[model samples]
Target chain A: MLIKRPDDIKPSDITDEKIYHQRRAFLQAGSRAALAVAAGAVVPGLMFPGEAAAQVAALQFKKNARFSTDEEINSLKDITRYNNFYEFGTDKKDPAKYAHTLKTDPWNVRVEGEVEKPADYQLEDLIRESQLEERIYRMRCVEAWSMVIPWVGIPLSALIKRFKPTSKARYVEFTTLYDPAQMPGQKRGVLNWPYVEGLRMDEAMHPLTLLAVGLYGKVLPNQNGAPMRLVVPWKYGFKNIKSIVKIRFTETMPNTTWNLSGPQEYGFYANVNPEVDHPRWSQSRERRIGEFFKRKTKMFNGYEEQVASLYSGMDLRHSY
Target chain B: MMMYRMKPALIKPLVFIACLFPLVFGIWAGFTDQLGANPIEEITHRTGDWALRLLLITLAVTPLRRMLGWGWLLRVRRMLGLFAFFYACLHLLTYFVLDQFFDWDEILKDIIKRPYITIGFSAFVLLVPLAVTSTNAMMRRLGKRWGQLHQLVYVVAVFGILHYLWLVKADYLLPLIHAAILLALLLVRAWYQRQALSTRRTAPQTS
Candidate 1:
């Protein structure tokens, strides 16, 4: 029972994998064909054009070059196909293979807890109200692999200011969409249903933090955490929770999924410190998604200039 | 009885070809750039998977021989053992060459200190003598000692399975499957050994 019967669809309505590929072949001459053909393309979403085109509508945003990395970004194929969205499935490829089933058409984000605005915000209205910008950032996984992703979204600071947290709000906790019907992986207890992640209020309000709505100038692919996901550039990849449904401004430290799974391996402040190796493997070096030889991993994934001051006095090794 | 009648000469080549399939297919996938985003990781995992799979398959042979009463299956066991060693070599090569990039200092550190790697590396090292003593000439030279030495395979199997168990992050599905298979095979072998000992004790000894 690796793949359970999805509740949303009648068994007959489900597209067979064979016929799905055949249909992709039939539509090969169309716009979606570019993804199937874009083998070495640098853009992230091109590799999943079918998933992108079926649900992802294009977005308009200003390019913030000051914050964006000049380094060549990994192809959309690499970013979209190679993911750590455990909600979709534990395998990196599972998201792209199965995330098409996630119904995000009428999505909403509930902003609760200590926030002044405690209401369910529609995904569309929030995107429209927030000032969107495209920022390219390097995301390093705890597994010692890295990817340069150009994300289109509003800064977390902008969204935080709009929400207006109360005095007691010390942490911002995020929760992923939870529906076993849409997310087949949720049916199994991978890391407790409804993945949870939290950041200190200051960290959440940092200028670099992004609530990414799209990727590579297009709506974020479902596999890549559409209609939106949190992208914390300086922290390990797991900190960037995807397919977020709830944002809670809390007084106490919230329990994150990975930290709860393995407390020794993961920490509350999972800043990418190359010095602090994971319990199982070394983090001194990371293989960039498209590169051959392993390169020396940098402190805070090369965002030390912007984020170092945030943890200036704190011992990263202890926090990690 | 029918399987025992099957010619080893005919089956040996097929087994050899079957053992080589994973390597050939992995190379084909590599050349096509179909190994996905992280080709190095993909290649490492594929090779490691085949190595463990072959090891498990090799372990299965003894129990199958006893259970089905196909004593002739022993003739094929050496080739399977060697193939397991061969894939294990490829698996180590992938990690050593592709992942580490000849970084001996790092490799040595991993082998010496890292529990998962330490266990896996020790298992691979244990496999070397078993592979070396597998030849018919060496088998005859060592005589009874050969059987004692090859018992190391059972220890190697435990280490190999433990290596996989420790390495996986959260998904224990595959490792658990491998553990179950190895456990069943070992249990069956132990049961057969006890049965053999009891039968020998009861039987009239001409010697």
Candidate 2:
């Protein structure tokens, strides 16, 4: 088990290798001063040298929270954009190709509509204000592919809380970056431009909902949304909007691209419950590419304990 | 007439070069990993597209030979027809071996369940007889019946176009272009055959 109840090793135990070597040498010297301190000394927490560099170099966000542990950092790296984000391009591989041109710098997210503090926030400011946590998530793409990834990002709840949504704001609407001058795909209208996706406010604020910044222990590649993206792990890949530019707290449900294209096929919730099948294909089994054969998809991608209750009263068939 | 006989051999090198070009490109692309994540799909699509195009060229020969009064086209028809089969085989191999991993069960299901696969498989199966009988020895053995047997290429061509048209989710423009070319070539053949029949009827009076 890579993670064993978190207490097996403390950060101070793994501090600068040079200092630890000196401490070890002093202990070996059998000096009275070293021995006196060594007897009741508190273990100094050690951080990877790279983490120190990252902490200093990392652009200031809402709060100065570093990744809690290295394990969390590694997990964040694996998930972000392994699946296709096709509003950017047609091919499954296209997102990585076409999204490279996306400018994530100077990102100002418009948090407007029914929120009490309806204001635009710079991405850097938004990050500086919140706590970033690492969440290990099982991501399932609608195309029947799955991956386990660790994502580093502030929780969606942290970002949403700043806006202070009014009681009338029943749903939250998210819009992707859309500029035909920069994004050529938007010119052809393969899908509705300014690709919109939505979630109920409670679902939006779920602890599992992540506003991801980096993957694989590094800042996201431009194709993977360089600065920030939404990661709704239990839902299909498309529900995880990339390079978001707008987030509106709305009273009515927002029209999503997939839902608008074919309302009968794509429902708003778009949860990854195998019980609900896509119009063209069955979602019962998914092929994790690295795995040889079919692996049964878990209900809500194994976050049933956290998310299953949200859909309890509603008929999944209707919501599907 | 003596000089014209020497000119025909010049076409052999041209024919050989044309035949080798696609194979060279396909091989080079495969070796260099230029086919991206799904090389087999790229190879399959390229070979399939070439096969359909060559099949169109093969069909065009008869109408061209009749209209231009150039009977020399009959000499190259076998070579072009074989090239179409060559690419078609490669197309099918890519799909069956690379794409399906030779899983006979899945392939059988695809053939039965998918209409595009059914059309394509039928076209390839029809091509086998045409390819087998393309030789001069078989042509001599079959005699006049050879023409009737080779008529199967027309049906194969139609199915080939239909196979392509059915597989696409959108952007029907490419298949529609193929269909238009095929219809025009078939119409020209029908017109040429009618002209030949009328010419045969008037031959005695001219003599």
TM-score of each: 0.89, 0.68
lDDT of each candidate versus the true structure: 0.81, 0.69
Interface RMSD, every prediction, one decimal place: 0.8, 4.9
Candidate 1 per-residue lDDT over residues A117-141, each given as its tens digit: 8989877656652256678999999
Give the Å shift of residue B72 in candidate 2.
6.8
- Pick by lDDT: which candidate is best? 1
- iRMS of candidate 1, Å: 0.8
**Who wins the DockQ comparison?**
1
Q: Candidate 1: what lDDT?
A: 0.81
Error of 1 at A255 (Å): 0.4
TM-score of chain A of 1: 0.83
- Residue-wise C-alpha lDDT for candidate 2, range A176-279, written one tens digit per residue: 88887556667665677888888887788766678877554334555565467888877887788877889998888888988887687678988987887675
